[model samples]
Target: MTQTIAIDNSQKLQLAPLDIPNRLLLGPGPSNAHPAVLEAMNTPPVGHLDPAFLGLMDEIQSLLRYTWQTQNQLTIAVSGTGTAAMEATIANSVEPGDVVLIGVAGYFGNRLVDMAGRYGADVRTITKPWGQVFSLSELRTALETHRPAILALVHAETSTGARQPIDGVGDLCREFGCLLLLDTVTSLGGVPIFLDTWGVDLAYSCSQKGLGCPPGASPFTMSQRAVEKLQQRKTKVANWYLDMNLLGKYWGSDRIYHHTAPINLYYALREALRLLAQEGIENSWQRHQKNVEYLWAGLEDIGLKLHVQQEFRLPTLTTVCIPDGVDGKAIAKILLNDYNIEVGGGLGELAGKVWRVGLMGFNSRTESVDRLLEVLPQVLSK
Candidate 1:
């Protein structure tokens, strides 16, 4: 038996009103959410399997196809962040003791090796120093020598804001009888992730970065050949929840229950993708490119140097070297507390040496860039 609280006593319970200041998000991820996305999240909840909700799911998949520039039938949103999608891709791709070749450029590539290793893959990496990219010859040599089951790479290295060129990698992987898995978490909507055109076998992205949505959902797509590899796995996938085969059944024609889908989050991402569709992927990509250039110009004018090489720098995110005699974290702290502008610190080997600045999706605009440029110097002085 439970006792009910008296109305008089309940009235005396002090509750501080929630206070959240408006902030300009220009960090590595979790960029400012579009108003449409927030409104969609406020919509009344519906059952995941409801006829209306199922239609929404179908639309989400279609919109993801547009965003990813692919016609793949297996595209769907995983109920987690970017790493979850990465883990799911690796977990589903190779079974125990399978050999895999990973290109290690920055932090995310190393993560792919770990994810594959967890599934008992014998991981070998063709390594490049931080803030650098591997030459095609080096990658090809490794691929030919290892002849592994999969070639894993991070399309955008968030740690150093370096973008890897994959123009010939997919063809090379195919020639070497290997599958290509790519991490596009920070690159997807902000740049071109031409999955079908590039012949990529597997790709994954997160909602927080380029999608301008909250971080709960991760969108992933796998080619038919990649699906075949999963089907032929001798052992069941180690991760039950992220097992793509069973997930396909639920997300496929059957619509069977594997787990309770986060209905509200799906609503949020669906509306986010709807906005992206309206904007058109190519236009959105161009907008990101333009804004990032503007940001680079301002940073250069202010005497800040870019860490990544000009040819490999990521358009959505820029890693800037901290000026001599200035404290990176201190400047970021001042900007956040005093100006309500949030930026990011570096990660892994780049930490304390650079600042990762993001111009992604809804936050990629002239006003946002201008405001940051205007205030950054002032914050740095103090």
Candidate 2:
């Protein structure tokens, strides 16, 4: 048999420049990055262990504390996305056979239950109807029944655009010997977050939503009580990378090695925090609130309806019901393809029924509000 050797001639692929549209992102998350934030992302990368990089990390943590309004010592940015920090917090806090009470008010609330279950927790959920807030009576009853090791709730439920009340629930969790875990990814920089005053033991958030930074970093804080509980845990955290013990060393003064931090994302996050500080947290909240009003005013004029009630709607994100005879997904497609604007379709149980419109951070300006409002009538007419 004569064997013929064939030469491989596959060409190395050439990189192509991506041509992106000038989109006004009015979607659920990744609203819009300020120009300053984009510039920050262009900064040169530095080694994770370099003194300058470590210094930047320290500043990032301090700014996150200011943004979160928490003085918790165990505060830092997880190197991945929002869900990473949320999973880390739960996996570190709950051990096998532990009971966790999750408040399922909307889509993100159900995510809490799933995360807790992944850590071998017996997840007991207290659910409210979509677009509704949990009543104090219902919460109190669930607390008495479950007596869980942790009480988890979403401060701003992104899917339903509902804001859950935190004051009473935080106090109840503390009184019932349950650590309070809050998901504030959509509420952190755009709203008032008094983590220390509210008795939140641990909270996690993302930069893409309210912070107006690109996706990649998850900002999280852990109260002293949560820290002590982790220290006393009988078993090691299931996930090694998210292990609070090792992560603490990297984020704390000890400065031990954990993983290679995403330098450019940190750069963008730092600038985002700087912008938030310049705006002032209270003022940022008011900005979102004002734009939400403007959105509702325009929406009502167009004969559209909001999904969540006025009293409980999230200022940063709004869920609007798709009008009859119009397809929600089709409207979104028109906005993206024709208008160069992006808004989210519904999620979970509310899928295809509602549209999620986010007035977050840099995207909360009057111009953005006007752009979406003006284009809506045209989109709906088709």
Which is the leading candidate under lDDT? 2
Question: Whole-model Cα lDDT per candidate?
Answer: 0.89, 0.90
Error of 1 at 246 (Å): 1.5
User: Where does candidate 2 stray beyond 4 Å?
Assistant: 1-15
Per-residue lDDT of candidate 2, residues 133-244 (tens digit): 8887888999999999998888999999999888877788878899999999899988778999899999999989889999998898899999999999999999998898
- Backbone clash pairs for candidate 2 read none
RMSD in Å for all candidates: 2.8, 2.7
- The sequence of per-residue lDDT tens digits that candidate 1 reaches over residues 27-113 is 998898888898898888998788888888899889998898888899999988888888889889988988999999888888888
Off by over 4 Å in 1: 2-15
- TM-score for each predicted model, relative to the true structure: 0.96, 0.96
How does candidate 2 score on lDDT?
Answer: 0.90
Candidate whose TM-score is highest: 2
